[model samples]
Target: MENYSKAVNLLTDADVIIVLAGNKMAKLEGLDLLGKGQFEQDFPKFAQKYDVHSIGDAFDQQISSWSEKWLFWSQLIEQYTNHYQPSEAMMNLLKIIGKKKYFVATSIFGHFFEQAGFNENRIFSVFGDWTLMRCSSGINHGTKDDRQVVQAFLAASKKGQNLADLVPQCSVCGQPMELNLPLNDHFYPDTDANTRFRWFLTGNEEENLVFLELGVDETSPQLFEPVIRLVQQFEPWHLIAADYPQADFPLDIQSKSAGLDADTATLIEQLDKNRDF
Candidate 1:
């Protein structure tokens, strides 16, 4: 609680609270941020591969056979980072929140931003979202997104093929589909598709913004580095961290090392109360 004062003071006026949570947090709260309902669909042998025992060992021992690491992480799940999300208690704490930019960027498919109700411009997830599925073929023939298409993709995966390629073909052109994520050499973003629909949203960097981090270990500090640099420029911006008993606060910026476990509900609640979140 060394600099809780600065963090609390800044949060009082923050326009947005960017959340960096992971799949573990999503699963704990009974939310579908990772599109868990379609987990097995996208990854055919997902559950069978990571059974209860193996999964427990992986997390407990940090041991992954070279094969499991590559096959499961490489071709199957393409991600550039490693992170575990915050629990539902964290989510409930955030849902009551509204303000600046709640960028929910996560290594696990990066849906935390949208999950917390932030706009595309405000939030950015490096890993693409499962909410969107691309076809392997091409834009026209490969996009089998609806329930029926996911089912077909699952069936195709069972036979040993990519879900993106398995999507039902385009009726007219008749071609394969691909997942929306940047799968191979040729991939592009849809300019016309706007999830915002039509809403007036705007913000300035000078405005209050809190990089509220919870349960985020030091494994991958890249995501927080940008904000850390920004604090040097805009000293008023808040960089609050609620890590476990073992976390080490940076020497420069102020941080709170609450050694308590991940529940974080009590600590966050306390911070919010003192800070007026």
Candidate 2:
């Protein structure tokens, strides 16, 4: 109760909000990549062939052909991103940050925030969205939308037809296109969005900023420590995390920060009911 109230006060008082999201937020939105809940049931062949019981394992498995890889990726993307629905937490997030200056930095590649009506320009996907594709030429040619190819693959699955001919090719080098995820060292993040996120932080340095952490765990160390360092450096910046305990926060910012030690969904639900927003 104490931490929740502290979080509410921090959120209400802030003029700007910076969301640091991780895999737990993805699970809340129905994209549990590392879970075994539906992976084996949904993809039995990959499970049996490669002993891969999770989407994370499947992604790491080196499928024999590009066609098979695209097929697997398309099905996953279709089930997650194409047919995604916003969760209660996502709705309450909008209410909490309503009409306020906000930016989202997420490790989830499912495009959940953008689908939930958050401004795409203000989002930086550190891991990259799977809805797009990049050239496989081992060079940074650029990214292209894979949604159209995904639709074709889905349609082919229904008719039991081979759509290998429809595999996307790079317009620049005529090589096969791969998912834009950071599966290899050649992955290139969206520079424009990165620049926008940096600019947002620079502009809000003097504002009352709430560094909101959602579902962040050990998997995304980059989003975790740097945010805590930022809160420590800026007097007006407060930290609100759904996972950590209040005792874990630095002494200097403890009064201004709150660690609810709760999941994203539960925290957002409480915040939604307590405040009119």
Q: Which candidate has the top score in TM-score? A: 2
TM-score of candidate 1 against the unseen true structure: 0.53
lDDT (Cα) of model 1 = 0.46
TM-score of each: 0.53, 0.97
The top-ranked prediction according to lDDT is 2
**Residue-wise C-alpha lDDT for candidate 2, range 40-141, written one tens digit per residue:** 888898799889999988888898888788888889999999899999899889888999899999999999999999999989999999988999998999
**Alpha-carbon deviation at 5 in model 1, angstroms:** 5.8
For candidate 1, the per-residue lDDT at 262 reads 39
Q: For residue 115, give model 2's deviation from the true position in Å.
A: 0.6
